[model samples]
Target: MKLLLAGIVLILIIMWKPMPSGAGDMWRAYSDMREANWKNSDKYFHARGNSDAASRGAGGRWAAEVISNAREWVQERTGHGAEDSAADQKANEHGRNGGDPNDYRLLGLPEKY
Candidate 1:
C-alpha cells in the first residue's frame, strides 16, 4: 500500500502543469506574430497594383487586420507596446518599393475631364 501511494504521488507530480515563464513565452509569441504579420503584409503589397479600389481596399484591410492582430498579440504576450516594429521594418524594406511603378505610389490613373 505504501508503494502504491508513493507511485501515485510520483505520477501526480509528473502530470502537474508547470507554471509559465512570463518573459520566455512572451518572446516566443512575439516572434510568431512577427512572422505571420510579415507574410500578410507581403501578400497585400504584392497585390496592391490592381486598379480596383475594392480589391485594393480588401487587401489593405486584410493587411491592416493581420498587422493589428500581430501588434495586439505581441503587446499582450510581451506586456510591452512594441506595435509591430519588425513587421513595419519588413514592409518598409522589401514590400514598399520592390514592385512596379503603380505599386510604389498610391496615385491612380489620371481622371478624364
Candidate 2:
C-alpha cells in the first residue's frame, strides 16, 4: 500500500512538471529589434541625401534584408511566411507610390513611410 501511494505521488509530480519555453517566445523579439534598427538606419540616411542614387539604393537594399530577416522570425514563430510576404509586398507597393489617398487603407503604414 505504501509503494502504491509513492507511485501515485511520482506520477503526479511528473504530470505537473513545467514544459520548456519556446525560443519563438523569447529570442525572436530581440532579433526583431535588431532588424528594425537596420531598416530605420536606411530611412535616416535617405533623409539626409548625402549620397547619390547608388548609395541610397544600397540603404534600401539593406532595409529589404532586415525585412527579410524579420519575416523569417515571424515564420519560425507562426509557420506563416506567405501571409507575411503578402503583407510586406502590399506595404512596399504603397510606399513606392507615395501611399493611398484613402485614410483607412493608409492606416497600416508607419507615419514616416
Candidate 3:
C-alpha cells in the first residue's frame, strides 16, 4: 500500500538522518515558549521551532517536519479543533520554507525570546 510504503520511507529517513542539533533547536523553542508563556503566542513558537530546526539543514528540516506533523496529528485526535491544527500546520510549513519566525511574533513579546 502507498501508506505502508510512505511509512517505511519515513522510517528510513529518520534512521538515515537522526537530527542532532535540530532536536535541541526544537526543544529550545519549546522551552522558550513555556518560559515566555505570552498570550496568543502558540503559533509563533510553532514557527520558531520549525524555523530553527530547519535552518540546521536537510536532516533538521526532516526532523522538524516529522515532529510538527506528529504533534498536530496527536492534537487533532485529542479534542483540538481542526481549524487550529490546520493553522498550526500552515505556520510549521511556512517556517520550514524559510519564512521568518518573527513574522508570527507578537507585537510586544518579551525581548528575551
Top model by lDDT, which number?
3
What C-alpha lDDT do the candidate models reach, one value each? Answer: 0.38, 0.38, 0.88
Question: Please, what are the lDDT tens digits per residue for candidate 2 over residues 1-113?
Answer: 99999998886554333211112222332343344454323322222111111122333333433444465567658876676556544543343333432322222334442
Q: lDDT tens string, model 3, 31-101?
A: 99999989889899999999988987788888899989999999999999999999999999989899999
Q: How well does model 2 score by local distance difference test?
A: 0.38
TM-score of each: 0.23, 0.26, 0.83
lDDT (tens digit, per residue) of candidate 1 on 1-113: 99999998875554332212222233333454354454333323322322121123333333433444465567568755354555444443333233332343333322210
Better of 2 and 3 by TM-score: 3
- TM-score head-to-head 1 vs 3, winner: 3
Candidate 1's error at 34, in angstroms? 18
Instruction: Choose 1 or 3, whichever is better by lDDT.
Output: 3
RMSD of each: 17.3, 18.7, 5.1
Q: Indicate the TM-score of model 2.
A: 0.26
Which 10 successive residues of model 3 have the least lDDT summed?
11-20
